[model samples]
Target chain A: MKDVYFMERDPYAPIRHCYGISKILYEGKSKYQEIQVVESHYFGKILILDGVVQFTEKNEFFYHEMLTHPVMFAHKNPQNVLIIGGGDGGILREVLKHKSVKKAVLVDIDKDVVEVSKKFFPTVACSMDDPRAIILNEDGFKYIQDYKNEFDVIIVDSTDPVGFAHVLTTEEFFKYVFEALKEDGIYVGQSESLHYHLDIVVRFQKALKKSFPIVDLYTTVIPVYAGYWWSFSVGSKVYNPREISREVDVETRFYSDEIHKNAFLPPNFYQKILNGNFKY
Target chain B: MKDVYFMERDPYAPIRHCYGISKILYEGKSKYQEIQVVESHYFGKILILDGVVQFTEKNEFFYHEMLTHPVMFAHKNPQNVLIIGGGDGGILREVLKHKSVKKAVLVDIDKDVVEVSKKFFPTVACSMDDPRAIILNEDGFKYIQDYKNEFDVIIVDSTDPVGFAHVLTTEEFFKYVFEALKEDGIYVGQSESLHYHLDIVVRFQKALKKSFPIVDLYTTVIPVYAGYWWSFSVGSKVYNPREISREVDVETRFYSDEIHKNAFLPPNFYQKILNGNFKY
Candidate 1:
């Protein structure tokens, strides 16, 4: 057996995180990006796309639960939800956990990612066959533009804001997301590392402020991510993302009602970060 | 010029975070540990000891501020302070910021760690010559056994609890620390990462629980550290480490009153982690 390792380099920063690989479960490319399913030395199985780690078996709940629950709990009743680019189905699994979610539409451009995830990561892709899930193999950028006042919550779980995926974070695309949502809707997307990509975080938050009344940034410690301080940007029409409208009633490893509130940056700290007080 | 990279392989896990190096400022070994001061491509100068990153110029504030302030503010009148193994002098600089601190003594096993830091990291080592500060080069494990009811606060800023440093975290050593502190004293040490070394954290906190009435864990995101979510274990005799005794009147980049409270894990989340609720 040959010793193999996966080098997860951050294009935004001059650093990388390396993971020792025990076995390569699957390796192939979709029409849009490269994909791989590798059994890791420590973190069980890992899903990698375009040279970036999407999640690991041991740590998927941190990213999935955070990306899903805050938005779901913030909305009064998330009867309908839109998940863009979550082809791995982790977000869809979390969204369906909400009793209020009548339908969850997951629009991902890469069919191979979903297929490989369903094949290699059974636990993460466990909820793909749920009746409430509506999987669409199309670009969410185009799919979101077709709906009007449809989704109660919209979550962009796409790759980094680069290449073709860049459109998901643009102001025009934000307009599409705002229009696709109901009058009182909540929106969120995984931004870059808060430490490495402050400029992008500020830019994304400022752009969302143009279309939404409430905008905020929250962070979590992702073990496999480049900086470990992975961030999520939130935009809400009426409700504050910091306040939870629903009590947590789902099975989760990381998300609790208290962790939800504590996860968001304090107002003064957030303002200071936006004001460029941080030199790092 | 060659492109050099610093591979910080975590001894606890089969993972490493790499930093691109622009220049090597210093590389040598003291009697205690191997040391290096290097200029990084994105994170400015970094101080490395025994293949582990102590702090980087770009993001030292997050670690230093987090390690210093909560214990400082938790005490009503923090007049006498003791620091064990903070050779970089970053903790000394923050400790000197409090007007209430009348005397601060720092003891380390390696003099080279202090010398190289003063030469290459002048900003971090700026307060070395303070009149009220005392610098001693000795093993803190042995140096701590000499005092009884002496200091208001005691902090251990040493390397990871490995090799010879392991003794500093033992229950016997914690008993020594308890005897060295005043009736209303506080103690804090750099525990392992919350994400990677939960077992070590639990063990250290459990050990501290035997010596102190109030023992808790706090965390902050350190970009260059192994897991990024660096944690500190705190034990106090009288004061609740969560409350602030004095206002933040010092100049700091990251520690504020709200962040001081926010840096701590929520009580329920902390309990859940202790109860083994989280998988990651």
Candidate 2:
């Protein structure tokens, strides 16, 4: 069989796969753009929604934890937050756990993903109907561009950097993130895998480094991702992502202050990339 | 579809997985018991070798790297070393890179894995036919039980605790390991995933804690196994795994002293486990 490339675009990150079709799970508008377990030669069951991989037999928690915690922990008093492209509500659920975060705004291009997640992935992506959450069916890039410094923390929970989500990984989008944040605002977005998308990660790092004074890259293990381990390039307007405290009020299954401190400890292979000795 | 369970009895550890046929990659013997991939609705890919996963799409490298590097780097002079159950030769390739390591002995139950890895995974599992290496098709458990404290370093590069490998993760086997160490001998092995298999990891940890005075747990990112982030438990008789001098002799695509040190930073969840809380 020959390889076929599949791309799922969200504002946060996009998933790209090259595989022959052996099976497809679910496909329709049910709250979320849901798809069932397909015939995956590498991984068994792959769950997709609105072109984004929601679950797999392998690993998913790493991506969920890394995407939510660092920025949430960095903000000392993140009362209001905005999540662009997280229709599945995983980020919203994580944000709601922070007692200090009184309100959240989730903007997604598609409403089908939200509906699907509400039905299937209730435990993880459950904050869809939270009292503190405001769901907006809109374009995240344009939404941020039109908004002011109104958010304490802004998380771009989009798909990969291609198709609709392509612009979100650029310096132009980060400028909007900076403009959309409070003075001490912090931003986190989906950085691709180091193994498969090394060049893309390097480009994002460069763009974020130029846009923000303090930018750091952290990674997690995600089975369905091109590379099992996925990275996030973080940019902050005022604070350093390094200053971690034991003052987190959120109850998380995977994150803690110790993890917050440990996340910054990049592998030497990655250290070489940060030090400019290694490129892609 | 009915679920089928497979057991991978590496000389070190043994792992069992329940999977659908879609999860099975390759079966039967070629150069190695090469299994491509199998999907699990819950666990991800069940990478079977002779009906067991030698290297799944998930947490295989965490075990492989941790078992090879700590002891290889800790010794001031490691001229000769013995590896039991690393049939895939991933560890052999890592050991060969240390210019100080002149000879490496790899003992495996199946020769098919070694031969197949020599063909497919040539990068990490390369150097199968190197001049400085010896491939032994024998029972590693018996081999260790017979050999006295002769080698500088001995690595347990086996599978999980399922079938034949179940003996390798026991106290009695570790006693054999202790006997097979030099005055300053070091040993490392694949414990289990800190996320899903903490019960096994804790059992392995408790067993090693009794055998060796110094026992530590470290982690790395592996996406294809049960969990994305995987942990390895290390046991030392006299040397500390963290006392690494930043001097690296061999060029590496992945492993390094810097990477070596970071691997020991257990996540906070696992930190609680090591601290005597095995709740997760």
Candidate 3:
């Protein structure tokens, strides 16, 4: 059979990526963004939103595990967890791995993403039906306004900070998140790449520093992402992310005790990145 | 002006990259490979070898500093160094930064790359005329066979292990490299990306292990590289690469005291990668 290629159309990235597709599983428009599912010859089944790849079956574990486990293991005991904009349920599946968590609240502005994930990505969307899961189809920014010091952990697993998601990185949204978290609560959000989005990362870190006592950054490599060196910004009210406070016993493909320590950027490199000392 | 895109045609990589070129500076076939220089809108001037990106002025420091400094600092005092296949002279520029090094030898099969780099990439090719530098136009595989326990450090800065460069990763070639090094000498080489080239990395590590006391893997993210998460395999006769034996007093954009310690992959992760336990 001849091969068909899916060329990504990412306006923000200087370089683009092309994946060889074996078959197209689904393609449609969600109320929020364009949705696509294809069986790739190299990366297996992939999920694309508005021409940007979210994850693939072959390497989603690296993204999902790195994003979920580091913050989960940092907290002493996270019983109440909240996830923003993760309609795909990959974060929900990982959050449920911690036995201490009694409830997980997921709020996404788009209902179509959840429905499509349930129909096409069954394994990734497995935790949506769990007894501890609470699904809310609403604006996550407005949803957090009702609570004050209620949740132990808040994960912003949204798309790139563009269009509807741009507000998620603003100072106002960070203030709301600070008010919604407990005194010892931790907040983590996907902060884009350190290579292409260093300015945005510095802006986000500056905003995070205004709201939290301890702000840190960690990184992982996701091949599907246009900027392959993906970054995550963390804001803590009291805990230090450098040391894993709790023991990690979860079954993961990429996260471990040593990896947690190694995932963070060294202090000198981090300072250099923020100061714009390193040229890309 | 209209934009022209240069889509990389890498056979080994499952996905390909496309760079937006503002102008083509040079394009011709050398004795060994096709070389091209173009002005990229995002990455500044970029050097393309046989349709694959060799380096860009915007981000070449990340690759050169990461590849050269770690091995240089690991040794207590490196007086004689041998570099194979770094025709662009970026590695030579970095090697000359060390004041303790008395002599530096560079061997590459192609002379056109060096001439083009001297004309187009002056900053990278600046060290070609240094008093202690020796530029050789010969095959590295054949040239290294003449030396025995003569050099303190050997760096393989070759292109992908394909076409004419495939022998650089073989056990036979590694034996020659081991014979060319001093008793406590160090060897470092570009082992390809950890994302798509795990099997190649494992083969290189296994080959290094047979010839050295310690074989370690370190990583850095190079944006121009298709698999951004690139790996480097290091083989040391006596020193453990985890700790820096000499103080890093050189001026660098990426390598630092903290970075050198953190660049190495943890033991568990390395074991998992070699065992093929981690999927993507």
- Against the true structure, whose lDDT is highest? 3
Error of 1 at B266 (Å): 0.8
The sequence of per-residue lDDT tens digits that candidate 1 reaches over residues B9-51 is 5577567778888898888989988998888878889898888
Per residue, candidate 3 scores C-alpha lDDT tens digits across B184-205 of: 9999999999999888988899
lDDT of each: 0.88, 0.70, 0.91
Q: Tell me the tens digit of each residue's lDDT in model 3 across A1-280.
A: 3457888988679898888888988999977899999888888888899998898888888888888888888999999999999899999999999999999999999998999899988989999999999999999999999999999999999999989999999989999999999999999999998888888889999999888889999999988888788999999998888789887978887889899999999998898888877645
| Regions of candidate 3 where Cα sits further than 4 Å from its true position | A1-3
B-chain TM-scores per prediction: 0.97, 0.79, 0.98
Sort every candidate by lDDT, greatest first: 3, 1, 2
Model 1 TM-score on a 0 to 1 scale? 0.98
Clashing pairs in 3: A280-B58
What stretches of model 1 exceed 4 Å from their correct place?
Answer: A1-3
* Per-candidate TM-score against the hidden true structure: 0.98, 0.78, 0.98
TM-score, structure 2 vs. true: 0.78
DockQ each candidate and list the results: 0.82, 0.20, 0.82
Once model 2 is optimally superposed onto the true structure by TM-score, how far is the C-alpha of residue B122 displaced, in angstroms? 6.5
